[model samples]
Target: MGTFQIEGGHQLKGSIQPQGAKNEALQILCAVLLTPEKVVIDNIPDIVDVNKLINILSNLGVKIQKLGKGKYSFKSDALQLEYLESEQFKKEGGGLRGSIMIVGPLLARFGKGYIPRPGGDKIGRRRLDTHFEGMIKLGAKFRYNKEERFYGVEAPEGLKGTFMLLDEASVTGTANIVMAAVMAEGETTIYNAACEPYLQQLCKMLNKMGAKISGIGSNMLKIEGVKALNGCEHSVLPDMIEIGSWIGLAAMTKSEITIKNVSWEDLGLIPATFRKLGITVEKRGDDIFIPAHTEGYEIETFIDGSFMTISDAPWPGFTPDLLSIVLVVATQAKGEVLIHQKMFESRLFFVDKLIDMGAKIILCDPHRATVIGHNFKSTLKATTMTSPDIRAGISLLIAALSAKGTSTIHNIEQIDRGYENIDERLRAIGAKIIRTA
Candidate 1:
C-alpha cells in the first residue's frame, strides 16, 4: 500500500484547477451502453474507481481509446453483456458503489442485467432498495441468488414507464432509474428524486441524446421515453466536492489559494454554509480566492440565535461527504461548532483521531460532535493513521499537513479513489508531501 508522509506547518499558496465530477463521469461512462454509437467524454478524472470501471467496460468488449489527458472516446458497438456475470464484474462491482448503474443500461439494451453487491465507503447502511424498487416499478422482475450474492433483472415486455416516488433521495438510485426510464415505453414521472448538479448534467446529456426531460433542477422529473439514443460528446462539470475540500484546506492551513474554473452558479448554499464559520471567500470572475491568515474567526449561531449546528441533508443543502472536512477545519478555527452528520451514523467516528492530536473535541454520539478550535496551537502530535474512506482520508491529510511533525497516512488507495493527483497539486502550492510504498 502507498502512504503519504507530510511535513506539517507550511502554508500552501497558489492556484488549483478542480477536476471533473467523479459522480457524473461514472454515470456518463455507463450511459455509453445505452447506444452502439461512439461517445466522446472530456474532463474525466483519472481516479481509481473510474479506471476500474474502464477496465470492466474494456473486458466487456467496449473499445476505449484514450485521446489525451482527461479526454477519451468510447465505442461500445461490440459490447458483450455476458461480461456482467464474470469475475471481473465481481472485482469491479466490489470496488465501486456506482457499478449498479450498469444494471439499467444492460437491461434496457440486452433485456437482462446482472450485478453483484456493490462496494463503497462504510459510513452507513447505503440502501439498494431504492434502485431495485424503482426498476421493479418500471416493469422489471428481480431474482437474487444466495450462493452468488448477485442480483439479476429482466424486462420481457420492455420497460414501461410508471409514476414512482423514491423513499429516500438516493444519488445512484436516481441515476439508475433515470437511465432505464429514458428508454422505456411511456412517460416516466419521478417524484422526490435527487437533482444535484451531477444529476442535472446527466439529464442534460440524456436530453442531448434525444430524451425529453423536464424539471431539470427540481426534485421532480418528467422523462419521455425514446425509441433509441445516439452517442454525443459531453464535458463534465467541475467537482463541487473538490471545491469544498479546497475551501476547508485553505481555511485550516491559513493559506491563500485561488481555485479556477469553478461553477459558481452550481455552488448552492456552500458559500453561505462556510460563511457561518466566519470564513470570507472572495470571487473574481469564475475564480474563488481564500485569504491567508484569517484574523479572528468564530462560529455563528443558528437563525434562532441559538447554538450553531451544521448538518447534512438532500440536494441544495450541506453535503454529508464534506462534513468530515468541516470537522477538521473546525478544529483549527477559533471557536466551537456542532457537526451533525444526519445521513450517516458512523461518519463522526473519525473525530476521535483529531481529539488525540491535541485538538479539543467531544463525540456526543454516532451522529453528532462538538469541536473546539485549536486556538493556534503550534504543535499537533503526529501519528501513524489508516484511511477508512475517501472523505475521511482527505480530512486526515488536512490535519496531517497542518500538524507539527511528520505523519504517515497508509491505505492511500482510498484517497486516490476520489481526489486526483493530490500530492502533485499540494506540492504546486508549497505543501511538503511525499508518496512512499
Candidate 2:
C-alpha cells in the first residue's frame, strides 16, 4: 500500500493539463477488438486501470506498439481466442471492471466471449445483467457458471440485430451492446441508451471506422450492421472528473489554476453544478481558469429560500462521479446543501472521513448527506484516513490540502487507478504532497 502525506494551508497558482478521460479510453480500447486492422489511439492516459487493460489485450495475442507518449497502435489480427478459457486469462481479466467490456467485441468477431467476475471500487453493486440481457436480445446464447463465477456468451450462427430497450442507461452496458451490434446482420435500434460524452465519442469513432450509427448525442441510437470495420485513429477528450476535482481543490485551498484542453462542449452540466456552490469558473478558449477564492464563497439557495440540493442523474444531468468533490467543497462554503447520490448506494459513506476532519456533515442515509459549510471560520484539523474509492480518494486529498497541519492518507492506489501521476502534477502547481510506500 502507498500513502500520501500532505502539508495543508497553501495557496496554489499555475496551470495544468487534464489527463485523457479514463472512462472513454476504456471503451475505445476495447473497441480495437472489433477489427483486425491497426487502430492507433492518441491522448491515452497513463493510469493503472488502462495499463492493466492493455496488458490483458497483449496477453490475448493482440499486437501493440508504443509510437510515442500517449500514443499506441493496436492490431488484433493475431488475436488468440483460446486464451479466453485459460486460468491466466481469468486472473488478469477479473482484476478490473473495465475488462468486462471486451466481451462485446469478442463475441461479435469470434462468436464467443467469456469473463470471470470483475472487480472495482467498493462504491456500489454494479451488475452485469444489462450487458448480458442486451446481448441475449441480439440472439446470443448466455450462460453462467455459479461455482466458477464466470459468464460466457456465444452466437454460433452470428448475431442478428434487433430493437432493445435497456432496463437502465448503463454506460458500459450500452457501449458493449453497440460494439456487438455493429457486426450483426440487419438494423439495430437501442432506446434509453447512455448518452454520456464517452458513449458519444465511441459512436463517432465507430462511424469513422465504417460503422453506420446515428444519434450521436441522444438517448436513442440507430446502427446498421457492416460486413467489416476498418481501423481508425482517435484522440480522447480531457477527463471531466479530474477537471472537477481540480476545481474543488482550488476552491478549498484558495488556489488559482487553469485546466487546459478541456472539451467545453462535452462537459455538460459540470461547470454549472460547481457554480451553484459559488465557485468562479472562466472559459478561455478550450481552458477553464479557476481563480483563487480569497473571499470565501457561499452556496446558492433556491428562490424560495429552501436549502439547495445537489444530486446526480444520467447524462445532461449532474454526473454521479463529481458529487463526491461537490460534497467536499460544500464543507467550506457559507451555506448548507443536501447531496443526493442517487445512482450508487454507498458513495456517500465517505462523508464520515470528512466529518472526522472537523467538517459539519450529516449522513442522512447510504445515498444522501447534508453538509453545513464551515465558511473558513474554523480551519480543518488534519488527521489520518484511508481512501475508499477513486473519487472519494481525491476528495479526501483535497480536504487534506485545505486543512491545517499535516495529514496522512493510506490506500492511495485507489486514486492512481484513474488519475495519472496526481502527486507529481499537483506538486508542479505548488501543492505540498509526497507519495510514500
Candidate 3:
C-alpha cells in the first residue's frame, strides 16, 4: 500500500479542472453492451474502478481502444456471452456492482446473462434485489447459485415491458431496469425511481439511440420500448462529488479557486448549504469562483436562531457523499454546524481522526454530530491516517493539506480508486503533497 506525505499550512491558489463523472462513466460504459457498433466516450477518468470495469468489458470481448487523452472508442461486437464464467472475468467482474448491470443488455441481446455478486464500497447493505425484481417484472427468470455467489438470468422469449414501482430510490437498480425496459416489447412505467443526474444522462443517451422516454427529470419515467439501440456520442457531466471536494479544499486552505465546466443548474442546494457556513461562492457565467479569504464567515443558525444543522437526503437535497468533506471544512469555519448523515450509519466514525487533530466535535450517535469551527486556531497536529472510504480518504487529504505540519496517509490505493491524478492536480494548485510508498 502506498502512502501520501503532506506538508500543511499551504494556501492553495490557482485553478484545476475536474475529470468526467465516475458514476456516469460507469453506466455509459455498461450501456455499450446494448449495441455492437462503435460507441465513442469522451472525458473518461483514469480511476481504478473505471479501469476495472474496462477490463471486465474487454474480457467479454468489447473492443476498447484509447484514442486520445480522456477519450475512448468501444465496440461491443463479437462479445463472448459465455466469458462471464472465465477465471479472468470472475476475478475482475466478481465484486464490482457496476458489472452486474451488463446482465440487462446481455439478456436482451443474447437471451441469457450471468453475473457474480457485484462488489463496491461497503458503506452499507446494498442489495441487488431491486435489479433482479425489475428484470423479473420485465419477464425474465433468475436463478442464484450460493456456492459460486453468481446470478444467472434467462429471457428466452425476450423481455416484455411492465409497469412497476421500485422498493427504494436505488440508483443502480433504476439504471439496470431502465436499460432492460428500453428493449422490451412495450411501454414500461417506473415509479418512485431515482432521478439523479447520472440516471437522467443515461436516459438522454438511450433516447438519442432511438428509445422514446418520457418524464426525463421526474420521479416517474415512461419508456416506450424500441427494438434496439444504436451507437451515439455523449459527454458525461462533471462529477458533483469532485466539485464539492474543491469547495471544501478552498474553504479549508483559505485559498482563491475557480472550478470550470461545472453545471450550475445541476448543483441543487449545494451553494445555499455552503453559504450557511459563510463561504462565498461567486457565480460568473458557467464557472464558480471562490474568494481567497474567509475570516468572518459566520456559520448560520436555524430559523428559530439555534445552531445550524446540515443533513443529507434524496435528490433536491444535500448529498450524503459530500457531508464528510463538508464536515472537515466546517471544522475550520467560524461557528457551529450540525451534520446529519441519514443514509449511512458508520460514515461519521472518521470524525474521531478530526477530533484528534484538535477540532471541536461531538459525536452524538452514528447519524449526527455537532461541529464547532476552530477559526483556524490551534493548528491541526500531523499524524498518520488511514483511509476508511472513498470520500473520507479525500477529506483526510484535504485536512492534512491544511494542517500545521507533515502527515502521512497510508492505503492511498483506496484514494486512487476514485479521484483521478489527485496528487498532481493538488500540486498544480500550489499544494505540497507527494505520493510515496
Model 3: per-residue lDDT, tens digit, 1-437? 88999999889888778888898899988888989888888988899988889988988899999988889999988998768877667777875778988888787777778888878776766789999999999999999999978888889999898899899887888888888888899889999888889889999988887788999878899999888789988888888889989988888888999998789988888888888888998897988898876473678888898889899987877888899998998998888999999988888988999898888999999989999988876667788899888888998998998898999999888789889999999999899998997
Candidate 2: give the clashing pairs.
Answer: none
Name the runs in model 2 displaced over 4 angstroms. none
- Every candidate's lDDT: 0.88, 0.95, 0.87
The estimated TM-scores of all candidates read 0.98, 0.99, 0.97
**For model 3, where is the 10-residue window of minimal lDDT?**
292-301
Colliding residue pairs in candidate 3: 95-118, 95-119, 96-119
Worst lDDT 10-window in candidate 2: 81-90
Better of 2 and 3 by TM-score: 2
Q: lDDT by residue for model 2 over 1-437, one digit each (tens)?
A: 99999999999999999999999999999999999999999999999999999999999989999999999999999888888989998899989999999999999998889999999889999999999999999999999999888899999999999999999999999999999999999999999999999999999999999999998799899999999999999999999999999899999999999999889999999999999999998899999999999998999999999999999999989999999999999999999999999999989898889989999999999989999999999988899999999999999999999999999999999999999999999999999999999
Candidate 3's C-alpha lDDT? 0.87
Residue-wise C-alpha lDDT for candidate 1, range 1-437, written one tens digit per residue: 99999998888899999999888999999888888888899999999988888888888888999999999998889987767888878777867888889888887777788888889888989879999999999999999988877988999889998899999988889999999899899999999999898999998988888888999989999999999988899999988889989988888788999999999998887878888887878889999899986564567877787778899999988888889988888887777899999999988887777877787889999999998886676446777899998999999999998888999999999999999999999999999999999
Q: How well does candidate 2 score on lDDT at residue 329?
A: 96
